[model samples]
Target: MTATLDQPTAVATGVVVRPWRAVLLRVEGQWTWYRRHWTASLLSSGLQPVLFLAAMGIGFGSQVRPGPLTGGMPYLAYVAPTILVSGLITIAVAEAGLPVLSGFKWKQDYWAVASSPVTPGQLFTAELVWITLRLVLGSVLYLVVTTLVGGWTSAGALLVAPIAILTGAACATPVMAFAATTKGDGHAFAAVNRFVVMPMTLFAGTFFPVDRLPVVVRPLAWISPLWHGNELARGVALGGLRLWPAVGHLAVLVGLLVFGLVLGRRCFRRRLVV
Candidate 1:
């Protein structure tokens, strides 16, 4: 007996199959598209970060004397890891916001994919996975540039890649949830970049310590995922991160990621299922 078109091929062969296989297949499709247009993405995720490091961390850092503001280290060493994570967060926000909106609205590809055997939840997971892969590639490239430029202060900086991905996801998943709820020509995405992403990047202790901010504005940095990520990445790179504090920062990032994942999954289901 042969399996019908609707029947599972693995089941016919007396093998069990996992639902996540569909999610992986969807991620593969995303990868195929990314492979073709990766050069465009490389500009933002890779080259842009390198230029920022060279101009801000190296060139400008040379004129500033190391002090309490820089933790007694060269300004470049003090700022490199934070900038790396910030770049990842920027890329993640862009990928998760407008592109997600396009997938549902302009492209309508989500609906077409949902018409198949894949579930809405699987589609969400696939999107998250694809974003993770992109972040990884970008982080690796950024780290290599940092090393060549002598911006990486410690060997432990190698761990920044995974931490950067976590940081990006913490931001990306929430933005994706917002995108799933939007029904417009993506004007809201511009507002998100302006009002949300830009503020977070500027005030999240990426270029300077959050402590330098006015007392009234300090809370904003404390609540920002980029702040936590910057603290962790800088601590690891500079060899100052304590174990308990590291755990606390990791917990916050993980919490945000979980909350966003749940919210995004629900939003995707509501939008795609009906």
Candidate 2:
């Protein structure tokens, strides 16, 4: 290889050197924060999806066997992406919960960090970035678990790992935005999860196709960030991604992310100052 470099190589003192120190520092900080509360993290992300995967896919799979969802596929393969998306949503929900509450109430660490070198917007951005990082980790772990439990297919499902991260980030934008608006715990998160997150998770076609549900219920899936992410994940995992549909998934995801970020920044300013 003629000088392999994953990042920028600069000429320093007449020598070509890659400065990874900054990247390494950020990685260390992320890891430091992650390790402190990884157990609760795993409960929401990895285990939650795994449980659903088995309960519906294997347990109830016999009841729905040989259907379109099977798609001439094993029930496990067909359901894998949905599980991955649910895992992403679970991660998103976790991101929306305690961390937001802690930042506003228990810890107040975010305010302190914002007061220093970091601005409120930067603090929000950093936390969002951290959520994405967590999403990536949880997705990878879930994929591995699924694989070992016999969910891997075509080696393409391996690609679903990082896609889960993007899927997670897509929803995380909204989660963080929602978090940024809060003045107190005050059961705000409880309401968001009960009303918003729960409905999305249940009706969002994660376990089965939206068409299977009544027409009245299917529309909710269209509005859900997780549903779009699930569609994208299923397409990628099953190799069913067509141009228009793929573009549709991407468009919806990006739109949600943009909306979340823009609204979230405003919320950050409002909550942090006046």
Candidate 3:
């Protein structure tokens, strides 16, 4: 009897497949779910930011005259980019935090997904991609509204979307990692929102220059990813950021995002694979 050994079909055919294809399939599944509820998502991600701009940037800003802090521009112009970053961060935190916990605990969806060919790292990447899709959609809407409200000053303002997404990733990845490790219902997420996110939004130069803050507390804003985002967004929108400073801000955001991704991947593997 002559037994023939089977050849590796993929190598023989010269067809190499990427591992990230599985991650994209998972992202497609998330897109399907998002499509069904896109209206509600739009309300939260799109309309909410517009309302905030209307109320704070326009209505409240009307009373504040141009000043040194505002660089002789309307307060609306000064605060618009900051608000955009704020909205991105809020949405990012929500998408990454509780839903992540639900995936592991309430719904056990992570377990279900892991049972397939998809690895834990791919699942984490898919989650980040889903969150990024939401941020991009929301940010586009915000930019349209900001333009209508006279918030776009420089053409460079267009860079806000990608910068905001980067900022969101900086915040979301670490939060997702924490959520992956949670063993209970997501009570801790609420605390994080109330304590950490709230303070960051208030103090991260969203409403004013961080330098204007007390010297003792200025370091707090210095360490906030939101502050870095706000600085870049406002600088680009106002046509003031130098090339080297812009590169530095981008590097900081990228660094945080990378660190968080590493931590999130490890946590996801620990929670799902073991």
| lDDT per residue (tens digit) for residues 1-274 in model 2 | 4456566676445432223433343446667976897775677646777777788777876576566656777787788888778777777767766676588777877676555444566656666777777677667777777888787677778767766677777777777777776666647777777887777777787777888888887787888877877787787788878889878878887887778777776777777874
- Residue pairs with colliding backbones in model 2 are none
Residue 160's lDDT in candidate 3: 80
Q: What is candidate 2's local distance difference test score?
A: 0.72
Residue 14 CA displacement from its true place in model 3, Å = 18
Pairs with backbone N, CA or C atoms under 3 Å apart (clashes), candidate 3 = none
Candidate 1, residues 1-274, lDDT tens digits: the string is 3456668555334443356898898988988887898777777556666778888899988998899898898999998998888888888988898899999988889999887778888899889988888888888888888888888777889888889889998899999999999988889888988988789888989888888899999998898899899989999888879999899999999999999999999999999987
TM-score of 1: 0.91
Overall lDDT per candidate, in order of appearance: 0.87, 0.72, 0.87
TM-score between candidate 2 and the true structure? 0.83
> For residues 236-264, could you state the per-residue lDDT of candidate 3 as single tens digits?
88977888988888888999889989999
TM-score of structure candidate 3: 0.91
